[model samples]
Target: MKMGMRKPSLKKSISARTKGQLTRRIKRTLNPYYGKRGTGWLHPKKKLYNKAYQKTTFSFWDLFK
Candidate 1:
C-alpha cells in the first residue's frame, strides 16, 4: 500500500500530563490580568473604541463643531 493511500484517523489522543501542561501554559500566559479582565485585558477598551470609531465619525464632528 502506498503511504498516500492511507486513511486519516478522525480521533486524536493526548496524555493527561500533556493536557495538564498545556493548560498550565495557557493559564500562565493569561495570568497577568487573571481576575480583572481575563485574556482580553491588553486591548479590550482600545478594541471597543476602534470598533465604535470605525462605524461613525460623529465624535470628530462634535469636537470641531
Candidate 2:
C-alpha cells in the first residue's frame, strides 16, 4: 500500500508562528536577553529586530489594534 503526505494544519501553522514571533518580540523588548540600550547595541551583532521602528507613539489602545 502506498501512503501519501498529508498537508499541514492551517490553524496549527498560524498559531505556532504567531506565538513564536510574539514570544521573541516580548523577550527582545525586555532587558537581560537584550544587552544594552543605545546606538552601539544596533551593530548587527547585538541588534534586536522588530516588525516596526523602535521608537513609536503607540498608545494603550493602539497597541491592541
Determine which window of 10 residues in candidate 2 has minimal summed lDDT: 48-57
Q: Provide TM-scores for the models.
A: 0.25, 0.28
Writing each residue's lDDT as its tens digit, candidate 1 over 1-65 gives 12222233333234445675787678778875543544544688976775565565443234556
Clashes of each: 0, 0
* Local error of candidate 2 at residue 27 (angstroms): 1.6
Candidate 2 per-residue lDDT over residues 1-65, each given as its tens digit: 11233344778768879996887778778856453446455565534333122333233444467
Model 1 Cα RMSD, 1 decimal: 18.9
**What pairs collide in candidate 2?**
none
How far off is residue 57 in model 2, in Å? 44
> Least accurate stretch of 10 residues (summed lDDT) in model 1?
1-10
Where is model 1 more than 4 Å wrong at Cα?
1-16, 33-65
In model 2, state the lDDT of residue 57. Answer: 26
